[model samples]
Every structure is written in C-alpha cells, then in structure tokens.
Target: MIIAEQKPIQEIKAMIAGYQKVLIVGCDTCVTICMAGGRKEVGIIASCLRMALQIDRKKPQLIEDCIQRQCEWEFVDTLKDKVDGVDAILSSACGVGVQALAERFPNKPVYPALNTTFMGMPNEHGLWVENCRGCGNCGLGRFGGICPIARCSKGLLNGPCGGSQNGKCEVSKEMDCGWQLIYGRLKTLNQLDQLEDILLPKDWSTDRDKGQRKMFRGDVYYEQTV
Candidate 1:
C-alpha cells in the first residue's frame, strides 16, 4: 500500500490562506488505512480549517468529500459539480490522488494535504513499515521472500555488507539486516546453498527510476473502457 502522512495544520492553512472557498478531498484506499486521508481524516481536517479560519476572522467556505479512489476518473468525476464552486482543492489522498485531481480539473488549483511516504504494509494497528520500493524487477524467488532492494539500506543484491552485526544493520539498530534475514530464512528451508549463487547487479533502468511505469491488461482494458 502507498503509505502517507498528513501535512501539518499550519502548512495546510498557509496553502489555502488566500482562498475564500476550499474543498477537502479524500480517498478511501491506501491513505485511509494509514489514517492519513480518508473520510474520517477529511472531516477532521475540514473542522480544523473551519476553526482556524474563524480564529482569523475569515469566513472561509470549506467543503469535504471522500471518494472510493482519487486515482480513477470515475471516482473523481463525482466531484465535478461540487468542485465547480470551490476556489481551491486540498487533496488528502496520496500524491497520485492529488495529481489526478489536478489533471481532471485543470482550471482549479489543487494542493496536497499529505506527504506521500512509500509503499508499505501495516506492521501493527498503528505502525506501518516500508516493504517495496517498486523496483521494476522482483527477485523474491532468489532471496527467500525477503526484498533486498527495499529492505537493505544500500539495496545490495549480492549479500550482507560488512555493516551487518548479529542480524542487525549498522545503519540503524532497529532494522534487521535484510541479507541476514534472507540467509536465516533460506537456512531454515534447507536451501542455504542458494546463497552461493551470486546475483548479478540490478539493471536499475528497468525499474521505476527509468521513467513513468505502466501496465496493461488487454481484457481488463477493453472491459473497463466499454
């Protein structure tokens, strides 16, 4: 999931300082799970803005709404009429959501209310840890299900660096050495010999860094379009 965090109240206020009317848009997907941008979060932010504007003796018109997804046109289209009267839009969704709104409503000014963090999973009820970097190629098969590209600080493909000590990484005491975890996992599976196979250096060009990434499923494409 794409993990994100809401921007500070002060910063958000500043962004809409000049606008007399504003719309707070939220997404019900990834950002919602992270408690960053969702219907609940949208209400909180809207109320906060209302109070803040009142304190400033400014009657700012604030409207709040949440969509099933801000990345899809169908979801965003629902706001067409509501957005028409708003001076600006404050997107509480992920970066993609903010951009999608901007693209959909070219004339309206759109601002981000959260900082897009990373692709992560909830480690617990309130904690989320980074999982994937969205590297174009995946090598989980070779690494015992551990992702060296994202878990390792240096994204080393071969093995643990000298910085690993007792399964922990030198970069941070809280982080487990990704390669160490791979080794242990493979050892437990009686597949430790796989480690002997040196992995070739990653071809980064094939990954996200190359450019905008896209995937197409012909069946789904036609069905959705139709």
Candidate 2:
C-alpha cells in the first residue's frame, strides 16, 4: 500500500487562504490504512483547520468528505457535486489523488494535505517501513524473497558489504543488514547455493525513469494513464 504523512496545519492554512468555501477530501483506502487521510482523519484535520482559520480571523467554510478512493476516475468522479460547491479543495489523499482532482475539475484549485511517502506496509503499531521501490521488475527469487535493491543500505546486488557486523548494517546499529536477512531466508529454504549465482545488472528502463507509465487491457479498449 502507499503510505502517506499528513502535512502540517500551518502549511495547509496558507493553501486555502483566499478561498471562502474549501472542501477537505479524504481517500478511504490506502491513506486510511496508513492512518493519514481516512474519514476520521479528515474530521480531525477539518477541526484543526477550522480552529486555526478561526483564530486568524478568516473563517472559511470547510466541507469534509471521504470517498472510497481518490485515484481511480470512477471514484474521483463521485466528487463532482461536492467539488462544484467549493472554491478550493484540500485533499487528504496522496499526490496522485491531488493531480487527479486538478485534471478532472480543470478549474478548481486542489491542494495536497498529505505527503506521499512510499509504497510500504506497517511493521508495527503506528510504524510503517518501506519495503519496495516498485522498480517494475521482480528479483526476489534469487534473494530468497528479500529485495537487496530496496532493503540493502547500499543496494548491493551480489553480496553483503564488508561493512556489516552481527546482522546489523554499518549504516546504523538499528538497521538490519539486508544480505544478512537474505542469507537467513535462503538458509531456511535450503537455497543457500543460489547466493553463488551472479545477478546481471538491473534494467532500470522498466522503472519510472522513462516517465509517464501506463497500464492497459488487451481484452478491453481502455488505458489507465498512471
């Protein structure tokens, strides 16, 4: 899932300064699981913003709403009525959702209230760690399911750097050595021999370097411009 952090109140304050009627839109899916832009969070932010704006002697009407998602066109299209009544939108969704609103509405000013952090999952309560870079390629089989490109401090493809000691990376004692985890996983699977195999240089063209990635369906005449 895509993890996001909510922007501070002061920054959001400056966004809707001139707009009299502002809508605080939340995404109920990815941002919800990450505890940043859910319906509950939307209410919390709206209350905070209301207080902040009131103190400034600028009382803007805040309308709070949460949709199933703010990324897909189908989900975003549902906000047409609410958006028509607002001067600006303070989106609790990620940057993609903000852009979707900007493109869909074309005239309304949409501001992002959350910073899109990364594609990761929660490791513990209130703690989310990045696990994948979404490089558009999968090489987990050779590394026993651990991704050296993302987990490794140096992004080493072959083996652990000499900088590691006692399962902890030299980068920090709190950080686990990526290769150490891989070695343990491979040992458990009886695939330690796979470590000897050299992996070729990663093909990064499959990544976001090319710009404007898209997905489509051959069975249907539709393309998703992501």
Candidate 3:
C-alpha cells in the first residue's frame, strides 16, 4: 500500500492562508489504511483549520468530505457537489491523489496536506517499513522473496556486500542485511543453490527514468497511465 503522513498543521495553514473557502478532501483507500488521510483525519484537520482561521478573524468557510479513493476518476467525480464554490482544496491523500484531483479539476487550485512517504506496510502497530521501490522490473523470485533493491542499503543485485557483518548492515548496526535475510529464506526453502547464479546489472530502463509509464489492458480496452 502507499503509505503517507499528514503534513504539519502550520504548513497546511500556510498553504491555504489567503483562501477564504477551502475543501478538505480525503482518500479512503491506501491513505485510509495507513491512518493518514481517512474520513476521520479529514474531519480533524478541517476542525483544526477552522479554529485556526477563526482565531485569525479570517471567517473562512471550510468543508470536509472524503471519497472512496482520490486516485480513481470515478471516486474523484463524486466530489463535484462538495467542491462547488470552494476557493481551494486541501487534499489529505497521498501525492498521487492530490495530482488526481488537480488533473480532474484543472480550474481549481489543489494543495496537498500530506506527504507521500513510501510503498510499504506496517511492521507492528505504528511502525511502517519500506519494502518496495516499484522499480517496474520485479526480481523478487531470485532473491527468496526479499527485494535487495529496496531492503539493501547499497541496492546490491548479487550477494551481500563486504560491509555486512553478522546479518547487520555496516551502514547501521540496527539495520539487518538484505542479503542475509535472503540467504536465510533460501536456506529454509532449500534453494540456496540459486545464490550461485550471477545476476547481471539491473536494467533501469523499466523504472521511472523513462517518465510517465503506462500499462495497457486488451481485455478491458483501457490504458492506465501511472
């Protein structure tokens, strides 16, 4: 899932400082699951903004609304009524969601109230760790399901680096070596022989370097631009 965190209140206030009316939009998909830009968060931010504006004697009008998802056009289209007569929009969704709104409503000024952190999941209750970089090229099968490109500090495609010591990375004593985890996983599955295979240098052409990648679906007869 795409993990994000809400921006600080001061920064958000500054973003919409001159706006007399603003709409706070929330996304209910990935940002919601990460507890960042859900309906509840939208309400909280709206309330705080309202109070802050009131203290400044701005008499600002604030609207709070949450959609199923801000990334999809269908979900974003539902905000037609809520966005009416709004001077600006404060999106509590990730960066993608903010851009989606901006694309959908070109005339309206849209601002992000959250910072897109990473594509990862929560390890425990409140700890989220990045697992994937979405490099577009997937090579997890050869690495015992562990992604060296993301987990490894050096992003090594082959084996552990010389700096790895006793399953810990030299960059940080608390960080686990990505290759060490892969080795253990391969050993458990009796696939340690796969380690001897030499992996060529990664082809980064499949990554975001090409700019604005798209995936086409013949069955659906649609193209998804990411």
Candidate 4:
C-alpha cells in the first residue's frame, strides 16, 4: 500500500489560513490502512485545525469529508458538489491523491496535508516498512519473494554487499541485510541453486525517470471513455 504521514499542524495552518473555507478530503484506501488519511484522521485533523485557528483569532470554516479514493476520477467526482462551496482543498491522502484532486479541480488550490513516503506494508501495529520500489520490472521470483532492489540499502540485485556483518546491513545495525534475508529464504525453500543464476540488468524503461507511466487493459477499458 502507499504509505504517508500527515504534515505538521503549523504547516497546514499556513497553507489554509488565507482561504475563507477549506475542505479536507480523506482517502479510504491505502492511507486508511496505514492510519494516515482516513475518516478518523480527517476528524482528528479538522478538530486540531479548528482549535489552532481559534488561537490565532481566525474563524475556522473547515469542512471535513472522506471519499472511497482520491486517486480515481470516479471517486474524485464526488467532490464536485463539495468543491463548489470551498475556496481551498486540503487533502489528507497520499501525494497521488493530492495530484488527482489538483487535476480534477484545477481552479481550486489543492494542498497536500501528508507527505507520501513509499510503497510499503504494515510491519506491526503502527509500523510500516518499505518493501518494493515498483521498479517497473518484477524479479521477486529469483530472490524467493524478497525484493533485493527495495530491501537492500544500495538496491543490490545480485547479493548482499560484503559490508554486511552478522546478517545486519552495514548501513545500520537495526536494519537486516536484505541479501542475507534472501539467502535464508532461498535456503528454506531448497532453491539455493538458483543463486548461481545471473539476473538481468534492471529495465530502466519502466523506471520513474522514463516519465509519466500508464497502463491499460483493453478487456476492461473502453476507448471511448479515454
């Protein structure tokens, strides 16, 4: 899931202070699971902002609302009615959601209330760890499901750096060596022999440097809609 954390209250205040009415939009998908941008968080932020604004002798005309997703135009369209009333929009979703809102409502000032961190999974109750870099090409098959590109500190594809000691990454004592984890996982699967296979170089064409990427399935998409 896409992981994100809310921006500081002071920063949020500065962004919406100029506007008379602001709408806070929350996402019910990725950000909700990670406890960042959700219905609960929307209320929390709204209440906090109201109090903060009160201290500044400003009347808070903040409107709190949530949608299924802020990334999809279908979900974003729900905001059309709400958008007509607000002067500014503060999105509590990830960076993508913020951009979706901006693209959908170009006239309104769309402000991101969270810093989109990474594509990660929940490690614990409130902890999230980066798992994949979404490098466009997937090579998890060779590494026993452990992605060396994302787990490795240096994004090593072949093996652990020689700097790893006691299964800990040389970069940090608390961090596990990604390659070491891969070796152990492969050993457990009794497929350690695959380690001898040389992996191909990363396909940079699908990389972010390649520019805005889009995917379509003709089976589910209609040409007329696009």
Candidate 5:
C-alpha cells in the first residue's frame, strides 16, 4: 500500500488561513489503511481546525468529506456540486490523490495535508514498513521474493554488499540486509540455486519515468463508452 502521514496541523492551517471557506477532503483507500487520511482522521482534523479557528478569532467555514478515492475522476465528480462554495480544498490523501483533485478542479486551490511516504506493508499494529520501490521492473523471481531495490540501502541488484554484518544492513543496525534475507529465504525453500542467476540492469524506462504508465483491456470496453 502507499503509506502516508498527515502533515502538521500548523502547516495545514497556514495553507488555508487566507480562505474563509475550505474543504477537508479525505481518501478511503491506501491512506485509510495507514490511518492517515481515513474518514475518522478527516473528522478529527476538521474538528481541530474548527477549534483552532475559534480560538484565533477566525470564523473560517470548514467542511469535511471522504470520497471512495481521490485518484479517480469519477469519485472527485461527486464533490463538484458539494464544493461549489468552498474557497480551497485540503486533501488528506496521498500526493497522487492531491494532484488528481487539483487537476480536476483547476479553478480551486488544492493543498496537501499529508506527505506521501512509500509503498509499504503493515509491520505491526501501528507500524508500516517500506517494501517495494515500484521500479518499472520486478525481479523477485531471482531474489526469493525479497526486493533489494527497495529494502537495500544502496538498491543493490546482486547479493549483500561487503557492509552486511550478521544478516543486518551496514547502513543501519535496525535494518535487515535485503540480500541476506533473500539468501535465507531461498535456502529455506531449497531453491538456493536461484541465487546463482544474476539479474540484468533494470530498464527503468519501462516504469513511470517512461511517462504515465497505463494499461487497458479492450475486452472491458463498451461501444457506448468508446
């Protein structure tokens, strides 16, 4: 999942202080799972903004709403009429969602209330750890399911660097060496032979840098939609 964390309240307040009317938009997808831009977090932020404005003698009108997703135009269209009177939009979604909202509502100033972190998975009750870099190419087949491009400190394509010590990354004691983990996992599965296969340089051009990557299925298309 794309993990993100909410921006500081002070920073968020500064972004929309000039506007008397603002919309606090939330996303119910990736951000929700990370507990950053979910419906509950949106309400808390809205209430806090109201209280802060009251204390500052600022009569700002704040409205809170959560959409199924802000990355898609269909979901953002739901706010067209509802956001008619708002001066600005404060998006609690990830960077992609913020940009999507901005693109959809070019006339309105859109502000991001969170910093998009990374592609990660939940490690514990409230902790999410980075996993993948979403590099245009994936080589998990040769690495025993561990992605060194993301987990490795140097994004190494080969085995662990000389810095690895006791199965831990040399960059930090807290981090486990990605290559080491791969070796151990491959050994456990009795597929250590896969380790001998060297990966070729990744073709990053095939990823997002090649320009917005997209996929379409003609089978799912309808004549009317076309």
Candidate 6:
C-alpha cells in the first residue's frame, strides 16, 4: 500500500490560518491503514485546530469529513456539498489524493496534511518497511521475491557488495544485506544454480528517470449518464 505520515500540526495550522473556513478531508484507504489520514485522525486534527484558533481569538469555521478514497473522481465527487461551504481544503490523504483534489477543484486551494513516504507494507505492528521501488522493471523472479533494487544499499544486481558482515549490510548494522537474503532464499529453494547466470546492466530508462508513467486499460470504458 501507499504509506504516508501526517504532517506536523503547527505546519498544518499555518497553512489554513489565512482562510475563513477550512475543511479537513480524510482518505479511508492507504492512509487509514497507516493511521495517518483516517476518520479518527481527521476528527483529532479538526478539534485541535478549533481549540488552537479559539485561543488565538480566531473564529474560522472548521469541519471534518472522510471519504472512501480521494484518488478516484467518483469518491471525490461525494465532497461537492461539503466543499461548497469551505474556503479551503486540507487533504489528509497521500500526494496522489491531494493532486486529485486539486485537479477536481481547480478554483479551491488544496493543502496536503501528510507526506507520502513510500509503497510498502507493515512488517509488524506499527512498523512499516520499504519493499519495492516500483521501477517499472521487475526482476524478482531471479531474486526469490526479495527486491535488490530497493533493499540493497547500492542497488546491486549481481550479488552482495563483499562488504557485508554476518549477513548485515555494510552501510548499516541494522540493515540486512539484500543480496545475502536473496542467496539464502535461493539456496533453500534449491535454485542456487541460477545464481551463476550473468545479468545485463539494468535498463533504468523504465524507472522514474523517464518521468511520470501511466497504464491504459482497453477493457474498461466509461458510461455516459443522461
């Protein structure tokens, strides 16, 4: 999932302070699972903003709402009624969601409440780890599912950098050598012979270096409503 963390309250307050009315919008998808932009977080942020404004003798209206998602226009359209009453929108979704809102409501100013961290999953309770770089080219078939591009400190494709000690990456003791993990996994699978295969230099052009990428689906089409 897309992982993100909420921005500091002070920063959020400063962004909406100039507006007479603000709406705090939450996303019930990725941010919710990370506990950053869920319904409960929206309420907490809204209440805190109200209290802070009251102390400063400011009377700006504050409202909170959470939608199923902010990335899709269908879910964002549900905010038409609530957004009409607010001067600005504070989006507690990921960067994608913030941009979606900005595109949908060109006249209104949109502010992000969270920093989009990475595409990852929870390793344990409250602990998330980066797994994939989404480089557009996937080589997991040769690496036994461990991503060398993201997990390796130097993004090595062939093997460990020869600097690993006791399976720990040379860059940090806390980090496991990604290649070492791959070797161990492949060894267990009895596919260590594949390691002898020579790999060509990775084609980085398919990655973010090329710029924003997109996918099109020919099977799905939109239906017009009269």
lDDT of 3 by residue, 1-226 (tens): 9999988887899889899889999998988888999999999898888887778877788888999989999999999877878999999999999999999988899999999999999988888889999999999999999999999999998899999999999999989999999999999999999999898899999999989989877898755576
| Per-model lDDT | 0.93, 0.92, 0.92, 0.93, 0.90, 0.92
lDDT (10s digit) by residue, model 1, range 1-226 = 9999999888999999899899999999999999999999999998988888789888888998999999999999999999999999999999999999999999999999999999999999999999898887888999999999889998998898999998999999999999999999999899999988887777888686757988888866765455
Model 6 misses residue 157 by how many Å?
0.4
In the order shown, the candidates' Cα RMSDs to the true structure are 1.8, 2.3, 2.5, 1.4, 2.0, 1.7
The numbered model that scores best in TM-score is 4
What residue runs in model 5 are displaced by over 4 Å at the alpha carbon?
221-226
Expressed as tens digits, the lDDT of each residue in 1-226 for candidate 4 is: 9999988999999999888899999999999999998999999999989999999999969999999999899999989999999999999999999999999999999999898999999999998999999888888998999999889999987788788899999899999999999999999999999999887777778878968888989899866754
- Model 6 over residues 1-226: C-alpha lDDT tens digits? 9999988887888898899989899999999998889999899888888888777788898888999999999999999888888899999999999999999988899999999999999999899889999999999999998999999999988888889899999898999999999999999999999889989999998898878998767688656676
Candidate 6's displacement at residue 24, Å, is 0.6
lDDT of 6: 0.92
lDDT, residue 31, candidate 2:
98
RMSD of 1: 1.8
Off by over 4 Å in 6: 221-226
- How many clashing residue pairs appear in each of the predictions shown? 0, 0, 0, 0, 0, 0
Candidate 2 lDDT score at position 47: 95
Model 4 clashes, total count: 0
Q: How accurate locally is residue 69 in candidate 3, as Cα lDDT from 0 to 100?
A: 88
- Model 5: how far residue 223 lies from native, Å: 9.4
Model 1 clash tally?
0
- What TM-score do all the candidates reach, one by one? 0.94, 0.95, 0.94, 0.96, 0.92, 0.94
- Cα error, residue 157 of model 1, in Å, equals 0.7
Clashing pairs in 4: none
lDDT of 5 at 127: 88
Which stretches in model 2 have alpha-carbon errors above 4 Å? 223-226
